[model samples]
Target: MSNVSYYTAEGLKKLRDELSQLKDVERPKASQAIADARDKGDLSENAEYDAAKEAQGLLEMRIAKLEETLAGARLIDESQLDTSKVLVHSTVKIKNQVNGMEMTYKLVAQSEADLKTGKISVDSPIGKGLLGKSVGDVAEIQVPNGIMKFDVLEISRD
Candidate 1:
């Protein structure tokens, strides 16, 4: 099965930049480390050589994984997103039913989720609960503690 992922333009660029940095910069550094270690002494007794080889293997694995992610990534057009309801890339303003606290969040792809920036993954508990909900609808999200209700005050693009 193919694992497809969606990303915003900035998120996609960040991924591509990371892949390029790993392949172009880190790959050669790993190769050089291996070569340096190999030149030090006999292969059987060289701990540096073993360590270098292991590091190279890890780097290669990371590169391969990023390549796969990039292959399956699709860019999302924010302009085409529906603002009438909560969906991926929707900037939603919600009010806590119990505390009366209001907060805003932008639902994004899992890889791009950053709470510090008010971006939450669509796969998250709150995001999943809020999906398909329109303004004035209440979302009951089940957390480890209990169910928390959030009233959808507004939904917009951007």
Candidate 2:
């Protein structure tokens, strides 16, 4: 059973571009590495050949996994999303009820999550807790430490 992943148009484009790079550039590089290793020495005792083979196997596995993820990727229309509740692609302003710290984050897909840019995965603890929450709603999130509370200040579609 393959899980479906939702992405914005830009996010989907990024994924497609990455897949293209892996297929066009990295694939050939792996093949070349194997060829170079094969020409180096005897088949039985060559460490370089074994290393190259292992590297190629890992590369192929990554490609296969990316392909699978791409197959189930679905593009989400930003304009169609409801801004009343927190959801994927929704820019939410939340206040930590514990320490009075306010933070804003845009909920994105797993692949597009970048904490540095304030884009968080919807599968994350805070994101999951914020899902379907509206303005003025208090959400109790379970973190590794303990349960933390957050107050939803606003929700908007970016």
Candidate 3:
């Protein structure tokens, strides 16, 4: 089964750029290294040749994985998203019920998740709990530490 996932325009572009770099630059370099090693000595005993072959195999595997990811990626239309509830690509401000601390987070695809930037994957515990929650709704998330409640303060599209 194909694993379909949505991505923002910027995120899609980044994936495409990385794929291009791997195919156009890294692939050629890997091939050249193997060729150079093969020409140096016998393939049976040459460690350099074996290392180059292994590196090329790894490079090819990475390229194949990237291609698969791109194949299943769909671009998300930000304008079409609803601002009334938390969803993928939603920017939500939530206040911790216990500490009264407020934090804003953007729900994004797994590939685009970056905690430092406040972008969390939709598959995450907090994101799953917050999904479909409207403003003023309370989300009880089951985290690794324990259960934590967050009050939805606002939902916006960014």
Candidate 4:
């Protein structure tokens, strides 16, 4: 059974758009590439044909995975989200306990997480530690390196 993933409207739309692009745009391109390579003669020794076939296989696998992910995705209503504590889709501002450095991150689904944009997956160490925390609450997160402490400064819904 596929595990369900919760997404905001925008995130769900993005996933749908990506899945459509892969099927509509990329699938055809992969097929054409295979056809072009096949026309180059002897399939026994043709590296291009082999490469094209491999690429198509990889593309098909990605399409299948994306479809499965979409099938189990549920959209979360942002307006109904509680702002009193950290949860999925919550925008949280936190401060480092030792260094006093402040950072903010929006907790998102694993598929939508992008560290460069300050979006973290709920499965992440910090995100897990911050979950259910209220403002001013201290969270001790265990990372690969060591344990890190953070103070929840604020929580808001986007």
| Residue pairs whose backbone atoms clash in candidate 4 | none
RMSD list, candidates in order? 1.3, 0.9, 1.2, 0.8
Candidate 1's residue-wise lDDT over 58-84, tens digit each?
A: 999999988888888899888988779
Model 1, position 93, has a per-residue lDDT of 97
For residues 1-158, what per-residue lDDT tens digits would candidate 3 score against the true structure? 56898999999999999999999999999999999999997899999999999999999999998898899999989898888989899999999999999999999988899999999999999989999999989999999899999999999997
Candidate 4 lDDT over 1-158, as tens digits, reads: 89898999899999999999999999999999999999999999999999999999999999999989988999998888889999999999999999999999999999999999999999999989999999989999999989999999999986
Q: Model 2 clash pairs?
A: none
Backbone clash count for every predicted candidate, in the order shown: 0, 0, 0, 0
lDDT for 90 in candidate 2 is 94
Best by lDDT, which number? 4
| Residues 1-158 of candidate 2: C-alpha lDDT, one tens digit per residue | 67788998898898889889988999899899889989987979999899989988998898888888888899998888888888889999999988999999999888899999999999999999999999999999999999999999999986
Worst 10 residues of 2 by lDDT: 1-10
CA lDDT of each prediction against the hidden true structure: 0.92, 0.92, 0.94, 0.94
lDDT comparing candidate 1 with the true structure: 0.92
- Error of model 4, residue 91, in angstroms: 0.4
lDDT winner between 2 and 4, please give it: 4
